[model samples]
Target: MKVAVIGCGLIGKRRSQTAMEHPLSELAIVVDINPAAAEAVAAQYGCESATDWKAAIAHPDIDIVAVATHNGLLAEIAIAALQAGKHVLIEKPMGRNLAEALKMAEAAKAANRILKIGFNHRYHPALAKAYDLFQAGAIGEIINIRARYGHGGRPGYENEWRGNPELAGGGELTDQGVHIADLIHWFAGLPTEAFAYLQTAIWPIQPLEDNGFGLFRFGDGAIASFHTSWTQWKNLFSFEIYGQKGSLTIEGLGKSYGIERLTIAYRKPEGGVPDLEDLVFDLPDTSWELEWQDFIEAIAAKTPYWGAPEEGVSAMRMLDALYRSAKAGAPIHV
Candidate 1:
C-alpha cells in the first residue's frame, strides 16, 4: 500500500516514518501547506514532496492517506480522501466537534473505506495490559474512575494553533481532555451524563480554556472525573479505576510523566491490606508503530480494528456534552 502523509508537522513526521518502516505500506509522498516542511520530511524519508494535499490524495497509487493537519482541516481532508477511495488515519478529537466527526464517519461509510482515528494512547504497554486485566475481570465491575492529565504551557503558547478556538476547537478539554474521555469510555463505556467547568487560568487564551474539570455519570451507576490542565508546572498522567473486587491504578506515561507503572490492588474480605501487584513498563514508547501496524493489519484482513470511527464519535460525543455542560453550567445527557 502506498501512503501519503498530508501535514508535515510533528505528528505528520511520525506517521510518515511509521509508514516508511512498515512492511505493509510505503511512504509515497508528503504534503503540507508549507512546501519547506513537506520537503524536509520528504527528504528525510527519500519520498516525493508536494504543497498540494489534494493532488497527493488523488494520486492513483496512494492507498492510505494520513491526515494530521489542524483540527479544522481534519474532516475536510478525511472526507476527500475517503471519497477518493483511500483509507484514512486521522488525528484525534476526530475533528473540531461532533458534527464534523459525524460527517467524516458518514463519508467513510458511503465510500466503504476504513477510517481510523489517531488514538495511540490505547497502544501504550501498561494501559494495554491494564485493559487485558480489566477484560479478564481483574477489576470486577468498575465502580468509579479518576484521571488527571496535563502539562505546563510553553511560552507564547497563546499564539499557537491550539490556543486558537477556530483551529483547535475547545481548549485543554478538546486537546488532552479528549484522550482522557476516550480512555474513560474505553474502560467503562460512554457516560450517561456529563458536567464540566472550564478556566483560562494562566494562559492568555480566553474563550479557549487552559484548564478543564469534568465529571461523568454512567448508565451502570459508574462515575468518572478528570481534570486536564495547561498550568500544571509538571507533566503528569494518572488514571485510577476502582471496582467491586479490586482496583487498577495506572500512573505516568514514561519520560517526563515518569516511568509507566500499573498497580493492582485486590480487596481483602477480612478488612486488612489486600494483595498488591505492581508492574512497570520501562520500554520506549512504540504506540505510534503499534497503532500503525494495527491499522495495516485491519486493512489487509478486512477486519475490525482499534481506533474505529464509531469509537472516535463516541469520544467526541462525550466532549460535546462536556462543552455544552460547561456553557450551560449544568449537567447534560451524553
Candidate 2:
C-alpha cells in the first residue's frame, strides 16, 4: 500500500512515520497547506511533497490516504480519497459530528474501500491486556464503567482551531470525549440512554465547552460515566470496569499522564478482601504503530479491525446524544 498523508501536523507526521515503517506500505507523498511543513515531513521520510491534498489523493499510486487535518476537513478529504479508490484512515471522532461521519461511512461503502478510524488508545499495552482479560471472562458480567480523561490547556489554546465551534463541531466532548465514548462502547457496547452537561469553564470559548461530563445507561441497569476536561490542572487518564467476578482498572497513558498501569482485582465470595494484581507499562507509546499494522493486515488479509465504520458511527452517535442531552437538559435515548 502506498500512502499519502494530508496535513503535516503532529499526528500526520506520526501516521507518516508508521506508514513508512510498515513493510507493506510506502510513504509516497506528504501533503499540507503549508509547503514547508509538507516538505519537512517528506524530506524526513524520503517521500514526495505536495501542497494540494486533492491532487495527491487522486494520484493512482497512492493506495492509502491518512486524514489528520482538523475536525472540519476530515470528512471532506476522507470521502474524496475513498471515492478515488484509496483506503482511508481518519483521526478519531470520525468527523465533526454524526452527520459527517455517516456521509464518510456511506462514501466508503459506495466506493468499496476500507475506512478505519484512528483509535490508537485501544492498542495501548495496558488497555490491550485488560481487554484480553475481559474477553477471556476474567471480569465476568460487566455491571458499570467509570472513566476520566483530561488535561489542562496551554496558553493560547482558546485561539486554536479546536476552540472554534464551527471548526471543532463541539469542544471537549468531540475532542477527548469521543475517545471515551469509543472506549466505553468497546467495553460495553452502545448505551441505551445518555445525559450530559457541558461547560466552558475557563477557555472563554463560548458555545464550545472546555469541560464535558456525561452519563450513560446500558441495558440491565448497567451504567457508565465519564468526564473530559481542559480544566484539569493535572493530566490524567483513568478507566474502571466492575463486573460480577472482579474489576479491571487502567490508570495513566505514559509520559505526562504518568506510567500506564492496569490493576486487576478478583472479588472474594466471603467478601473480605479481593486478590489484586498490578501490571505497569513503563515504555514509549507503540499504539500508533500497532494500529497501523492492524489496518494494513486487515486490508491485505480481510481480517477484522478495530475502529470499524459502524463503531465510529456508534461512538459519534453517543456523542451526538450527549450534546443533545446537554442542550435539552435531559437524558436522550441513543
Candidate 3:
C-alpha cells in the first residue's frame, strides 16, 4: 500500500511514521500548506513532499490517504480522496459538523472505499484491555460511565488555529469531547438524549468553549457523564465504567498524564469490600500504529472498518445534539 499523509503536524507525523513502519505499506508522499513542514516529514521517511493536497489526492501511486488536517478540512480532503478511489484515515472529530461528516460518508459509500476515523483512544493499551474485559462479561452489564480528559494549553494557545471557530468549529468539546463520546458509544452504544454546558472560562476565545460538560442517556438505561476541558492545570485522562458485576476504571495516558493503568473491581456477594486488580502499562504508545494496522486489515478483508464513516457520523450526531442542547439550555433528543 502506498500512503500519502496530509498536514505534516504532530498527528500527521505520527501517521507517516506508522505508514513507514508497516510492512505492507510505504510512505509515498507528505503534504502540508507549509512546504518546509511537509519536506521535513517526507525527508524523515525518505518520501516526496507536496504543498498541494489536491495534487497528492490525484496522484495515481497513492493508495491510502491519511487526512490529519484540522476538523474543518477533514471532510473535504477525505471525500476527495475517497472519490479518487483511495481509502482514507481521517482524524477526529471527523468533520466540522454532522452535515459535512454525512457528505464524507456518502462519498465513501459512493466510491466503494474504506473510510476510517482516527479514534485512536480505542487502541490505547489500557482502554483496549478494559474493552476486552467488558466484552468477556468481566464487568457484566454496564450501568454508567464517567470520563474526563483535559490538558492545559501552552502559552499563547488562544492565538492558535484551534481557537478559531472557522477552522475548529467548536472548542474543547469538539476537540477532546469527541474522543470520550466515541468511547462511550463503543462501550454503551448510542445515547438517546444529550445535555451539555459550554463555557469559555479561561481562554479569551469567544464563541468557542474552553470547557464542556455533557450528560448522555442511552436507550439501555446506561448513562455517561463527561467533561472536556482546556482549563485543567495538569494533563489528565480518566474513564470509569460501572457494571452489574463489577467496575473498570482506566486512568492516565502515559507521559504527562502519568503511567497508564487499568483497575478492575468486583463486588462481593455478601456486600462487603470488593476484590480489586490493578494492571499497569509503562510502554510507549503504539495506538497510532495499531489503528493503522486495523484500517489496513479492514481493507484487505473487505470488511466494515472498526471506526468507519458511520461511526464518525454517530459521534458527530451526539456532538451536534449536545451543542444544540447547550444553546437551548435544555436536553435534546439524539
**TM-scores vs. true structure, each candidate:** 0.99, 0.99, 0.98
Which pairs, if any, clash in model 2? none
119-200: candidate 2 lDDT, tens digit per residue: 8999999999999999999989899999999999866876888988777888988899999999999999989999999998
- What is the overall TM-score of model 2 with all chains considered together? 0.99
lDDT of 2: 0.94
Model 1, span 1-334: residue lDDT tens: 9999999999999999999999999999999999999999988999999999989999999999999998989999999999999999999989999999999999999999999999899999889999999999987999999999999988787788998888998899999999999999999998999999999989899899999999999999999999999998899999999999999999999999999999999999787898999999998999999999999988899877888999999999999999999999999999
Worst 10 residues of 3 by lDDT: 152-161
lDDT of 1 at 111: 97
| Cα-based lDDT at residue 294, candidate 1 | 94
Off by over 4 Å in 1: none
The C-alpha local distance difference test score for the whole of candidate 1 amounts to: 0.94
Q: Which regions in candidate 2 have their CA more than 4 angstroms from the true location?
A: none
